[model samples]
Target: MKLHELHINDFKFFSQVEGDSPLLKIDGNHLLVYGENGSGKSTIYWALYTLLECSFKKSDDEVRKYFKKTGDESLVNIHATGTNNTYVKTILKDALGNPKTYRVSRKSSDMSIRANTDIRESNMASDFINYRVLFKLHSSKHSNKNNLWNWFLEEVFPYVKKSSDPCLIEFEALKEGPTKFLDLNGNQLFPTASLQDAPSDEEKIFYRNYRDYKQKWVTWHFWLETFLTNITTRANDLINHDFKYNFKIGLNIIKKFPTFQATDDKIKWTDPEIIISITEYEGIQNPAIKKPHTFLNEAKWSAIGLSLRFAILETRLYTADLKILVIDDMILSLDMCNRDVLLDIILNNYVNDYQIILLTHDRFFYELAKSKIAQNGIANWKYLEMFEDSSGTFPKPLIIEKTNQISKVWQLYHGKEFSMAANCLRKATEKLCNAYLSRQERINVNYSVKNLHEMLEAFRTKGMANGLNQNNLIKLIEYKNRILNPSSHYDIETPLFETELKRAIETIEALSIEANINV
Candidate 1:
């Protein structure tokens, strides 16, 4: 299963009344999005993130508050009159190709979303990584240890299963604690304020709940120790193999250590700490590096941070049906070489295992990634560009769906640039010819030597034997000579040039049909 579509209304840079935003169609393909800074690309990131997180929230307001008009973090367009229709909706495709729709809105109830099994699994399966998430790993001072306690509590703990019951999550069990607890049959055993005035039977129940909660804490602590150790090994493996780094990440998760205050009527615990240390630097083993943030450069810090996150996600769940990997400008600190290595790791390792949504603001990186995707022949990837349109009262996101070669032909042609259109058409024809020949010859056809004239002649020869019509071949050759040839340039002001260019387009379409190809 994977995401099919994402729709947003009156959410941040997307406003329905502004007439700029379009329905973002994932179409179950991996997406590569490029948006400049202030272009509202991150809006897309937050929309998906917020929607999936709503399933786990205790109250609908926790999700709806973001879309409300009053909050500082409100995602609604500031120029909007109200938040009545502000929402984020996602359509996911199940294994059998059926779409399951889920929505979060200000006026709606989240009861159904909380009860959804697929959504719950999706929330657990997916991981959202950005520059901020990476920086959090080593954001602490060198004088102090890098503690990821709150990070794990908010991000990782919710997905981890309890040892005693795999169906129960650690976050849910830890949040309520012993007091104000619920029975297995969904009954509250005692009041939340205080159990002081409770009956003797209820008091016994509270004590039992406390004991069980303590046992759970102990079990979770043990599991976490093992989990950290295991993830450390995995992180080192990635650092060695993928990042090609010398140092290894040393992780120690300090247990919360449950405590009790009898008069408070609630269980209390210490704050857990995930201490990140560096070891084995530059062929030296067991280096006592207390402050990795201060010792290591930003590039090395990024490598360690990324590797740890990747390893943790891998250890959490090996695979899931609807896993999504959304990365937003995660390689900002890395140099060109490291950036390429990271891209390779993502493409070669995670591409097949997850539906990837790669967002970047760097045009060079975007083009580089697009070229790599083409070179690797990844067929089911979509490219999109986001721009900010500031013609209105507020900036709105302008989404443009980027397409392949022949689409560029139409783009240039529609822009009334006939010569450039002709050049693109020639390239498109060359690509189409190469595609047909490669399939027929059962070998990779080199594009550098396959000129337009030679390819047309070759196509006429081979395509005729495979049922291409003689008149269509002749017409394609005539159109190619008349318009597509680079030497036969004409002024854009001439009527004949535009007419012949249109004829060239029609001829390309006919050639494609006759050759049974799509350029």
Candidate 2:
């Protein structure tokens, strides 16, 4: 699943962030939410977790204090924010390119739970006061769990209902059955809250229609055993359906696979060096294997994180119906080769399947994403910039791009050695340099959005042969204003922008590949 856009209000540091946009335009399978440790980048992540009711193993109490009760008193209330009555609306694109929205809002004080009032919304509102509004929600937002479950069973995948299909199915195979989720359902599926009573008319219209209520959600687990093979996982006896907990393999193998026992309350994947490849658990270990999610040892650190995250983002953005991705600088840990390899994976594998949202403190990561899409003539991707100013109410995210240095640099970074991207940038640098060399010959009066817009427009009047297509040229020029001004999802009636973006990316990538660049 991928997130196209998110709107958060009255939640922690984000007092009323409605127009926040991502830093780059993406139509791939992965989404990354990049930020420094204290930038509230994860807040966007938590908002989704809260709405979906999924429990992240990492959140601590300090993060919880920022989510609770302070706002509205109405029948239908979301977690009450300390900031005025708040609203959070998340836009998602599904597997088939359909879009839907989910929103949670709370009224300001003197709460109510009358017959005319909806208790569920009130409870959600009450949860606001309790602290940290977590979701564990129906598969999607905007609606209730029951309806969602029904649709999943009747439409998306009915097999998810049985313990064998909807639940993670494991067989008693092998001399030592390594725990495996075959029929394979794990992260792909999850559980929801058991509601007590149906809500009032208004609530029923929204909440009752939710599919997560009576139904279950499922997906395959992420990690695999690298050090040990021919292993076995236990049965569903110890698994928790609602929260989607997995068997703690490292501890289970060491302590209790044969009646596995654990030595610690907290558990995590054991291999520190093992990289994850979402394409498959069985084939990735071999270097000869070819899959969408192949384990890779080579990538450029300056660009790898962006590549890996974007690969999945591009997939979801262009293909899936529900698009929401939350990444916390997952690529910050790699080197340059790994980064380049990662970018190739994204452009080649994930873009046709999802929508992506990402964050990064690294300018390198941002530039790499843009460069890959833009140089290839991709128009679907957009760049979002984040900053904090005391003069503002809270931290804000802005969408900005031009000459698209960020995108251009990102493209230059692919397959780039330590300073290769920086080196290639000399050509663009020469554009600036030659201008300086000839500054004495003739000149312009000033530098600003006004003059910049005028120049791009004048260039557009001359047409495609001079620079870009009409639409592409216009989008490039209007990019910054669109991000700063804010627009509704209603405005973009088609993922066509995203689709066109992906095809452009593919087109450019083909260029590199045709010339033997190994994209």
Candidates in order, TM-scores: namely 0.70, 0.38
Task: Give the per-residue lDDT of model 2 (tens digit) for 1-519.
Answer: 345556666554455543544323333334433344455555555565454331211233322333445323221113334455454555656558676555544332211211112222221211110011111111123332112222222321211211212222221121122222111222211111211143444223333322332122111111122111211122111121211222111111121112211222222222112222222223333234232122222221112223212321222212223423334444555556444554555454435433444556676876786677656554445455443322333344332233333245344233221132233233332332233223432225553222333433443454345443455545534432322122322233345433433333333333233323322
Q: Lowest-lDDT window of 10 residues in candidate 1?
A: 159-168
When summed lDDT is taken over every stretch of 10 residues in candidate 2, the lowest stretch is: 127-136
Clashes of each: 0, 118
Q: Which candidate is the best by lDDT?
A: 1
In model 1, which runs have C-alpha deviations exceeding 4 angstroms? 17-22, 94-97, 109-111, 141-143, 150-210, 256-260, 264-268, 316-321, 404-519
Error of 2 at 261 (Å): 15
Report every candidate's CA lDDT: 0.73, 0.34
Question: On a 0 to 1 TM-score scale, where does candidate 2 land against the true structure?
Answer: 0.38
Q: Which candidate is the best by TM-score?
A: 1
Instruction: Tell me model 2's lDDT, rounded to 2 decimals.
Output: 0.34
Model 1 lDDT tens row, 214-236 = 67767777777888788789889
